[model samples]
Target: MARQPTSGHEGEAPQKLRTSRQVYDQIRWDPRLDPAAFVIGYETRESGAEEIGLPRFDPEGDIPWHRIRYIRQGTTTVWDRRSRVDLLEGKRSAPAPSAQCGLDARPVHRSALALIPPREAWAPIEAIRQAHDRHVERWMPHINLLYGFLPEAAFAEARGAIAAALRDVAPFEVTLDDVRRFQHRAGATVWLHPRSEPPGALEALQARLEALFPRCSEQSTVSAGGFTPHLSIAQLRGEDGEDGEALVAEWRRMLPITFQARAIHLLSRRGDEAFAIRHAVPLGEPSPEGGDR
Candidate 1:
């Protein structure tokens, strides 16, 4: 029997086409997004090309990777300065990454991502969820620290709003001293947990975020009642709870990992469901010597 294509997908989906990253103006930055500066993901060059127009992007590069589910951005495509120019005049093809080095860079399309559910998304804020989740995952027992860094400044409004909310509580530092199992009725999660009481700063930060994006999933916010800072290891999809305990027993031996809290981020999802840093602000950086920005 032949497999019929889904509603939207027909014989073949349009290929994105191979183009120079530089010419395309579709750049990915590390940790933060600075419009004035763009970082190369991968570098490439082709023969006879005047200069390297786009940096090579090696999707297989050895960088710590995580996957994000996609959510919709507002309608209407807006272009940055460089992207505006590329669209007006058709894009030009440059040498491939291997053309310069000995590597062969192939064009690849990413898979569509599923979204995080609305309920579970915000449930992480509630204490009941945390307690049961910790029991189920096992890895939740050891979080001693919490750190959030925004990959872009656009989300500053969201992150800043959250931080302000935590102000009344006075922020506390966090330490995810170890990893533990996080379980819920839905499934098990391998996540990190805070070691000490986070400064009231965190509480206030959550308050602001909740107030600003009220419609967002409750799991998304960090309020006095909802915040438990931790690093995620993995999420389990299986229904068997017994396996969770065994996995935790084996994983607990690797305990006590620590990270610093420098900043928090507001991540935005693209049509493809890729998460991009939209905004970020430092948690511990001192203000300028003179005054404010």
Candidate 2:
């Protein structure tokens, strides 16, 4: 039962549909939209439909989506997708803590997108980072793709899109071929440079994923230089560390930390804890919609 489009003098019309499948599909496929607040209803033999609010309904038959006759996100009657009616119309009184498409918004970075080397390869990198790298306790050995990623709750809905985007990307080998340093005003940081032969695959995959969450453009090498992917292993400062130049030479001598780049990991962490894997989107193979593994 499609409802007539409400008369609007300013914004666009809400997408019309008869069932709740469309609502779930949009939440599944579109990465930019989310339901910060919602209500779902079922058709009854009586006059009005049976309605229930979210985070409150019980799944009697384990088939809630099938019974959903109509849905509303905030104040907007969300029939098909949030993109259609959530244009400042679904404004709720109390906003979501980290709503992707909610009326209330805040910067969130409890999760990240990274290319993690296999557990087999963590030995040497961890060995070096344990002593010198200051961020060892906070992060695993990873090549950061998009830090300050989408809020943790959004990853479930975004997984479908993430898999679709990486469907064609074949697994490739990544090498930490050389040692480089970024000099600061006070201290200098040394890192291992990442290289993948026929070089653009890693960077291209990064760019593609970045497009999905257009807001996480913090690490984009737009003006500074091309994407210079690196793994931080050592730090040298004036207070109490090895010589930056000597450390670079030493790491270079022990250069070429290599591993197969099979899948990209979606990582998350609890309060003040080290980040851990949430999902691994395998290259060339589409990751199925499911829980973390």
Index of the highest-lDDT prediction: 2
lDDT of 2 at 190: 74
User: In candidate 1, what are the lDDT values of residues 157-228, reduced to their tens digit?
Assistant: 334444454334432455445556544334455665555455454445544544544422123322323455
Candidate closest to the true structure, highest TM-score:
2
Per-model TM-score versus the true fold: 0.36, 0.62
Per-residue lDDT over 1-293 for candidate 2, one digit per residue giving the tens place of the 0 to 100 score: 33434534558765443335534434322445543366665654433466655423322222356556656777666663322333333333443344563211232456778898888888878888998887788788888787657766666666777888888889888888888876633355678888986587789888988887765554563224645677878767654345656666776787677888988888878777788887877778766554366
TM-score of predicted structure 1 = 0.36
User: How big is the positional error of residue 117 in model 1, measured in Å on the Cα after superposition?
Assistant: 24
lDDT of 2 at 9: 52
Off by over 4 Å in 2: 1-107, 221-223, 239-242, 289-291
Kindly report which residue pairs in candidate 2 clash with one another: none
